[model samples]
Target: MTIWLHSEVGHNQDAKKEVKAFNSEDVFTTPKPERLLERILILATNPGDLVLDSFLGSGTTAAVAHKMGRRWIGIELGEHCHTHCIPRLRKVIDGEDPGGITKAVGWKGGGGFRYYRLGPSLIVKDEWGNPIINPEFNAAMLAEAMCKLEGFRYAPSEDIYWIHGKSTETDFIYVTTQFMSKQMLARLSDEVGSERSLLICCSAFRCDPSQFPNLTIKKIPKAVLQKCEWGHDDYSLEVKNLPAAPPTLEQEEPDDRPANSRRKSGKGKPRQASLFDMGGDQ
Candidate 1:
């Protein structure tokens, strides 16, 4: 396996280019391909097995999957799906990395991605500029929104990000942006924490008695508001102007599968997720 550090290849240039990219909002976000791929590979599949990324972004998952000897299916929405996503994946697949550094950083070249995309967000906004969230805020949306703010990939297995506490034994966290009401707190205090537990979590806002003994709640992250991208008639920023690259099959068949399968036919290497995921989940 060829390992190339992105810093050496200068690929993080893309990441550095827009340290403030989230400040306003472009159309779509190009997930730190390496970072997100690292997390996805961790939570999802084992090498040589199939991997799926609903949000292809700049084709990071595809590139990583190929390099790690895994077959991947990706879905994306935006123009980059064709221009940015396809081209990037192709570069890695053909071992024609111009980034130069990823290759040197141990990036073993190989593999490819099949892109995909879904339709626009389900909710509809009105004249006054208020977002009309679909019937309810589902777990996926909440997870994504939380990740967008925290600058991390949304992971199902990893719950609870401890923000800060007033003291060594006390702490709080902004779990989900969905406003955390008092009733919810009572329930969580019962389950998420105990009389001795030092952690507390809340959503967008906390409207409850502050003297709840061992529990504390705070508003959702302020950066979430600053970093959000609003859309037409929507209050909370929308991921507008993004290259709507819906997921589509770029490659024709899955040839790599047979090869990796045959090579490790007897080793019985238990499937493993990406190494990066552990950092985020824990």
Candidate 2:
């Protein structure tokens, strides 16, 4: 038996034409050919396989993947994501778009996808180098995040405010902002019993470790200090304006400090910033 291999399925002009048809104007300067993506999809994946496009320029990959009966995720940081890609995908879902590889794949679409924006950062650092949870997080969100960080299941107990979560029936975790005194620690240790162990995470603790063998005490802020960025809330990928530099050499040397002293003090000329920006969860 013999098999003949065929390649070069799509032309660049076809891609341009498809974009013009869908967008009513050729907005994308370099749109990808749907037929090219279709060929790649056919070669590399089976139906229902997952496809991910990190830079979904014109939504060609996602559209092709959707038409091919594959689940797909596409991420784009630019405003065109909302202006172009989303509308095009919505049209594809409603079976209104007849361009691209739709006819070739026999696509009369009936699929849906939900859109979501990245929320605030979970943790951030304060000026004092202490880790603080984001104010945007509610009690439930905080508990969930703590459970994930500590490798415990999020199962808050209704009867016990101290029991925020657990790793096992005999091993439990508690999260709080209040300081735990030695008397309070003793009471919790007694409640946990000999067979069980308890881990308490709080702002501060006045108990001695030797007194409670079964109770593990951890101080917050210090414990999670190096875990993540403490106070940064926004994770959006947007360009930022920077401070302008002094125009002339005299303006640069406004102060009476010597040039060598300025250099030693780490006050050099302004450095060029990075062009590419990225954020949010991947």
Candidate 3:
């Protein structure tokens, strides 16, 4: 075992001086010396190893890790994440910061970092104690969230108004807060055509769902709620683990044979009908 003294690993005063080099106006309170982090990382990790600091108060661990050629993730819940961490990390990445283990590690910074802001919870309770989508979400955000909930890739089409997401090249999803009428459904069905399938998530709809063979209509909050389980003791499985939606049906030219007659493909094999094609002749 090697004894580490302030002379080698540095102390609290040294930490303050390091931070003052970049941000002297707002010095961080509880910062660990970069040399201290360097010693710990050198013993516990190697170059390119991932280091995680959940309580990143002054971003010292991440800064030292980056200089030492180690990958790092720093999580700070306080406002200092924006004030101190980001500013300090920026200097380190640009090779502008020359304090702490910089000279010792020969760190001429050449790396980058990405910052992500997590969104608020999707489900929130109303005054009536009913679960509803958080009103904080706008139209595009709500559509993207719905796409994630339904396991579809969130890629809205510029030309098509209803194409908010897609599970495949032929299967698509649409999300709306508007109440869907039968006439609107007819218009959507004509637009989607018989060649492809669409899943509609709306606030409300009037019409027998069976009327549209190519569309699967589900109400918004209800569909989202069904995908989430409440007050369950066993946490074994998640609702997101549910099976994927069925594939789109292959449309054929108007068949002259009876509806019940077996349709043969060009390869001389019987073609299987999708369960979603119930309204179409099987």
Candidate 4:
């Protein structure tokens, strides 16, 4: 014997009812019903399989996936990610949301999920074609991103700012936006010693490669300019029909400096890198 599943397992009204129970009002213009996701997951996946919802509107897919014993990932680009999805997921984890396929699926929730935000764009191009790091990035964030871009592990030294990361025990990477003179590079080469190598990324370096075979110098914005698209910053989908709003004080004249340089010039200590093992190509 064979069993056939109905294509229409849920209705829009059911989705509205589910959202209204938790949101107190119909905030979401359109939310997916948990039953629909349940049917789809049942057909396409098994317990412990991974499910991904890229545009997580009200997080119906994730909620259903969690209840169905599936590992899941959800991504939302708007503020609704925090305002709507997170609260809803919290309630789902605590078993407080009882309306959306909870009884049908025997979902008395007892699991949790983690939340993360994407960092600022790695590099942005100015009109002059110079590669400037995104103003939103901090020292640590920039260091970590550079490590990934250059094929190294982010491992900062507690006593050294230049030793931001390493590819091997003897090979390291240092990221800085300051101008580096030949004398400075020579000192760094001496510190690195003959056995190890150091890759220095700086805004300007007045030196020759022949002087220090163990030290490789790369100029910023120039070195990473051709790597990625630097013009298009916001990747989120926006409703084009909405009326344009006037810019606020903060938005009217945005600060283009890196996050750490908003106040005084070079105010605090630079951020030290941390250790993480991930693979990528330069």
Residue 172, candidate 4: C-alpha displacement in angstroms? 4.0
Q: Give per-residue lDDT, candidate 1, residue 197.
A: 28
Better of 1 and 3 by lDDT: 3
How displaced is residue 120 in candidate 1, in Å? Answer: 4.9
Candidate lDDT (C-alpha), each: 0.45, 0.70, 0.79, 0.72
Best by TM-score: 3
- Give residue 26's error in model 3 in angstroms: 0.5
Candidate 2, poorest ten consecutive residues by summed lDDT: 273-282
- What's the true lDDT of residue 54 in model 1? 69
Arrange candidates, best TM-score first: 3, 4, 2, 1
Residue-wise C-alpha lDDT for candidate 4, range 1-282, written one tens digit per residue: 143233456777788878777676547888878888998899899997768899999889988998998867799998878777888888888899998789988989777776768876677767896567777878788777777666667889999768988764566789888899989998888887776778787888886766887777877666676544455768554535422332333454544544322321111212222111111111
Q: Which stretches in model 1 have alpha-carbon errors above 4 Å?
A: 1-88, 91-93, 96-127, 131-137, 151-153, 157-183, 194-206, 212-223, 229-282
Using lDDT as the yardstick, the better of models 2 and 4 is 4
Better of 2 and 3 by lDDT: 3
* Candidate 4 regions with alpha-carbon error over 4 angstroms: 1-8, 46-49, 108-112, 135-141, 151-158, 166-171, 194-197, 206-216, 222-282
Worst 10 residues of 4 by lDDT: 273-282
Expressed as tens digits, the lDDT of each residue in 172-267 for candidate 1 is 223444565678666655653432222232345555545344454434433344445545474542335422222222432332333212221111
Clash number for every model? 44, 7, 0, 1
- TM for every model, in the order presented, reads 0.32, 0.53, 0.67, 0.64
- Any runs in candidate 2 off by more than 4 Å, and if so which? 1-8, 20-22, 128-130, 135-282
